[model samples]
Every structure is written in structure tokens, then in C-alpha cells.
Target: MAIESVVVRQRVEDLDAAVPFYEKLTGSTASRFAFAGVDLAGVGPFLLFAGSDEAVQRVAGVAATLVAADLDAAVEAATAAGAEVVMPVQPTPNGRRAVLRHPHGGVFEYVGPS
Candidate 1:
């Protein structure tokens, strides 16, 4: 399967403060989305969010959320490759996604547009 793109997700304590800094740093306006008590902004390949770190820890740190053309197939492939599902495949406010942990304990998210 071809990997489309990887997005790095970071959790911050404050959305209001984080957005402007990233907006200036990336030189682009952020596309906003809210889900599960978190506010998210996409700045290029970086997905910055304001939420609890503990909640974000379910997926691990600085790991890329891999975008797939076929999310279900991606999950199946990941599972077959020895990646444990951290978050099961499900439809979110934004899309269909799941988090998988590599054998080495690194975590990554696989997502597709709903």
C-alpha cells in the first residue's frame, strides 16, 4: 500500500495561544476542527491541538498520523504487520481513524476522510 502523507499531532494547554504562533510559523491559516473535547488545527503536516496530554498519550508523542486512501485496509495491514491497535477504527467528527502501536512501542494514527 502507498502511504499518502504523515501528520504530526501535538497537544497544547491553550488553543487560543497556540493557533497564532503556529499560523505565523507556518505562514498559513489553520483549518479548525473540534472533537472529543479538543480543538484541532492543521498547519501543513502538523496537527496541533489543545487538550489534555493524558488523553493524547493514548496515541503517543510526536508520532505521525498517517493518511490513507483506504483506512480499513490500512488498519488490516498494520495489524498484520504486528502493530497493536491503540484506538479501534471508528468514525470521528472529522473522519474514520485508528491508532496503532508499533512493536517498538511507537504510536501512529491512521486516518481517512469520512
Candidate 2:
């Protein structure tokens, strides 16, 4: 599957406060959204998220989120490449996603249309 975009993850204590800095840096308006009880802001290639300890911890440790043309294909390619499934495919705000841990230990989340 083709990778459409990549978003860097930033876990912040306050999403509202963090959004302004990224907006200025990227010269783009932040698109606000919420998922699994976490508040998120997308500014350019950065994704800033903030929420309660429990909520934030649920999404912690994911280094980046990638938009894939096909989530199932992405997962299959990842597994064939020696990646382990950390989180199975599941529904997300915009689509579905799955988390995979590479053989080298980097964790990545892939998202695509539902």
C-alpha cells in the first residue's frame, strides 16, 4: 500500500497551549479533533495530543502515525517485513488503524479509510 502522509506524534499536557506554537511554526491552522477521549490538534505534519493520564497512556509510545492507502495491505506488508502487530486493526476517528512494532523496536500506527 502507498503511504500517503506521516504525522509526528507529540504527547502534550495541554493540547490547547501546544497548538498555537505548532500553528505559528507551520503557518497553518490547527484542525481540532478528539479520539478515544484524547484531544488532538493537527498542524502541518505534527499531531499534538493531550488528555487524562489514563487516556493519554493508552496512545503512548507510538512514535508516528502514517496515512496509508490501504490499512489491510499496510498491515500485511508490515508483518511480512518482520513487524509485530501491537494493536489490531480497529475503528478510528477518521478511519481504521493498526499499530505495529518493527523488528528494530520502533512502533508505528497506520491509518486508512474505514
Candidate 3:
């Protein structure tokens, strides 16, 4: 499976305030989006998010989001390598995603075509 890009996840209290800083830091305009009632902004390789406590908690354990070339193949490979699925494949604003916890215990979210 080809790993496209790794997005560093940041949980912020206010997206409006955070977007500018991230955009400035990354030198890329923020791509605004939302999912599950949470506001999200993609600035370069960073993803900034802010929302209700429930939404925040839902993704709190995920250390990073990895863009995959094939979600199914990535999921299969991860599980085969001993990664446990924390969340099953689901549709996201951008594509489909699944959360997995690695054998060493870091949770990661993988995104790919729906």
C-alpha cells in the first residue's frame, strides 16, 4: 500500500483562531471542512479541528491521519500486522476512514477513496 501523506492532528478550542496561525505557519491556505459537527481546517500537512467535547473526545486518541492509496488494502495490511481496528471503515467528508491502534499502542486514522 502506498502512503500518500501524513497529517498532524491538532485539537483546538477555536478553529477561527487556529486556522490563521496554521495557515501562516504552513504557508498554505486553509481548506475548510466539517465532519460530525466538528469544524476542520487543513493547512499544508496539518489538520486543525475544534468542536464539542463529544466530537473532540471521539477523535482524541488518534495520533495522526494517514492518507492511503487504498483503504481496504491498508486496513487489511494493518490488521495482518497486528493493528486492532478502533473504528470500522466509515465515510468522511474527504473520503473513507478507519481508526486503528498499532501493536505498539498508538492510534492512527487512515483516509482514502470511498
Candidate 4:
């Protein structure tokens, strides 16, 4: 499966405040969405998140969320490559997601709509 893109997560107090800056920077409109009570949007490679402390903490310090056409393959490959699955594949509102810790100690989330 080909990796689609890496989306950087950033917590913000206000989605309105974040959108304008990211829009100018990416030169693209943000598509709004919600996941587990958290406000989510994408501008270029950035995934802006705004919500409560608990909601924001879920994705905080994630470093990045990797998107791929085939999340199953991605998870399988990660396991084969020696990464431990910290969060098993699970259904989300839009798709599936999982967290992994690489052999080198870096952690990241992989997500996609299967």
C-alpha cells in the first residue's frame, strides 16, 4: 500500500483562530469534521484539532498521523518491521486507526478508510 501523506496534529483553543492562519499557509480551505468530540480539520499536511483537554490529549504529542490507502497492510507491515502496536486497529467515525511504537522508539498513528 502506498502511503498517502503525513498529517501533523496541533491542539488549539479555537478552531476559528487556527483556520485562517493555516488556510493562508496552505492556500487551501479547511474541511471541517469531528472525531470523539474533538474538532478536526485539514489544511495541506496539517491536521488541526481543537477540543477539551481530554479530547486534545488523545492526539497530543502524536508527532504525526500517517495516511494510507490500505490501513490493514500498513499495520501488518509495521508489525513485521518490528514496531509494537500500542493501540490496536479500531473503527473510527470515518475509518480505522491504530498507534504503534517503532523499534527505534518513535511512536505514530496510522489511519485510513478501509
Per-residue lDDT of candidate 3, residues 1-114 (tens digit):
777899999999989988888888889999999887788898999988889998777776789998998999999999999999989999988889999999999999999997
For residues 63-86, could you state the per-residue lDDT of candidate 4 as single tens digits? Answer: 799998999999899899899999
TM-score of 4: 0.89
Each prediction's whole-model lDDT (CA): 0.81, 0.91, 0.90, 0.89
Candidate with maximal TM-score:
3
Ranking by lDDT: 2, 3, 4, 1
For residues 23-56, write the lDDT of model 2, one tens digit per residue.
9999999999999888988899998999998998
For candidate 4, give the lDDT of residue 3. 76
- TM-scores vs. true structure, each candidate: 0.83, 0.90, 0.93, 0.89
Clashes per model (N, Cα, C within 3 A): 0, 0, 0, 0
Show where candidate 4 strays beyond 4 Å.
Answer: none
- Tens digits of per-residue lDDT for model 1 on 1-114? 556999888777787788889889889898998776667888877788876766655544637889999898888888898989988899987789988888888888888987
RMSD (CA, angstroms), candidate 4:
1.5
